[model samples]
Target: MLFVKTVTSFMAVQCVRSRVCHRKFWGWLNAVFNKVDYDRIKDVGPDRAASEWLLRCGASVRYKGFDKWQKDYNHLPTGPLEKFKIERIDATESCIMFKGFDYLDYLEHVEEIKFQRCIYIQDECLERLCRIQNLQKSLQWLEIISCGNVTDRGIISLHLLKNLRYLFLSDLPGIEEKEKTLQILIRALPNCEIKVDL
Candidate 1:
């Protein structure tokens, strides 16, 4: 009877240790995964093992300038990435190349998007963003700084975001007539605070 109790206690202690180890492993993985950007994605993109690791722990991953290096790599394994619970995406100082918006479709939980300094963001990218049903409903804040490629046509697509509250478009050279565009946006979204630096 004593041996039985001792064995049970030992098993309980092992279980506790295993839980602690699992937590520690996940914590470490999260820390490493959060640092993944376009530069590191190159190395992780080709390696199946690294991609798998990212897929498992990349729910909180924030890829700034993802479009800068995205063109260099072939399509990474996205099967497991579909399950990632990405909430915020920042692609500042990058390019939103052809069909680049398609990659964000899987992120159903995305709320905030920052494309500040993205020189390649154009009408096509905005069109793609408009098509995202989840983003249309859930997205609240959007920042597009110094994106000269985005014209009035591109800005028109953003009117579909019924829930958007904050819109920032600073130093956009394409917007030749800023006041007219600002007026149009204000009339369309009376509740939203739109900021533009022409």
Candidate 2:
């Protein structure tokens, strides 16, 4: 299959409490650019420019907060995202609702992915995340926080990631089975370091 690749930009604004000035610049970008390669998206109430850079290298993006950027997202160049990185996405709040998990199939070069406050992610997405081993050969770090969806099944699924080095998990809600889950995740990265907060 031919992947139609293009490069696009996405910026977020007014998301964090501390970065008001940064939010202004992105907000301006959102206001001035109409139907540009980049779009202004808001997920988890507001958007952050720090995270939006992930899609700057791609054309089409299956981004969280698609609703906030729906109008802009529709305007993205109709082609494959050339290359992209994903970081610090609220999977439960954004991915599950937006079906952002499907986008992982197109992330051929994503080296790092951090999931935070994503409650919707479950075994199904975790299954897909495990499959990322085939795509992210250069991937080094995977961090997840406050993600109640990643259960033992999801933790066990990570065994295939041979290149993964740093694994960080914190504040996961359904972590009553912490020991078993940690053991499974540790087994996945026999050659790497594993850090977990129980």
Candidate 3:
């Protein structure tokens, strides 16, 4: 109990001082401690909520989790959560589905989104993603890594997000004509900053 409290206190100090723990600190603490105890980290839930609140209040940069349980609760935030980001996302075995993410209309402030190794993405899911125009307008940085099932249409829809500044799609499979897909993405998101690796 002492060890957990000490670490939790340390994390709280960092969060209160800077509003986020550095990546190295967050990673180190996860390695040093058993992160499954939700009670010890209840502050994290509020901290995450505060991050969203700060963004809605016009803070330019805000960061929140890599915590295991938080990933389990990645449903859309209750209100307009804009300009904030999820620095580390792991949706490994959670019931988190692409279909459920369509509730993303609530986030008008999310500028950057990263989905790492969330393998359930499919060609059909892209159409669903396309429906959320609010997300596309606010998104600036997007990364989809190791999503093996995403297809050409998924890449093509990147054009709908006009404000996208940097996009990174790595280790995703399906499109055979790499250059053609790149051209299509460029044409679609004419103002976006793009980099594609098949």
Model 2 misplacement above 4 A: 1-93, 96-98
> Across residues 7-89, which tens digit of lDDT does each residue of candidate 2 receive?
21112222344488677776455333222222233231112222332233122223432332211332543333332233223
Better of 1 and 2 by lDDT: 1
Clashing pairs for model 2 are 4-80, 8-58, 9-38, 92-118, 92-119, 92-120
Clashing pairs in 1: none
For model 3, residues 19-119, the per-residue Cα lDDT tens digits are 44465575454333212323422544433543333232222223444222232223434433332344333333222345345334444556665655654
Rank order (by lDDT, best first) = 1, 3, 2
Please give the lDDT score at residue 20 for candidate 3: 44
Clashes of 2: 6
Full-model lDDT, candidate 3 = 0.55
Error of 2 at 174 (Å): 1.2
Would you list the C-alpha lDDT of every candidate in the order shown? 0.62, 0.52, 0.55
What's the lDDT for residue 158 in model 3? 69
Q: Model 1: residues >4 Å from true position, as ranges?
A: 1-83
TM-score of each: 0.58, 0.53, 0.54
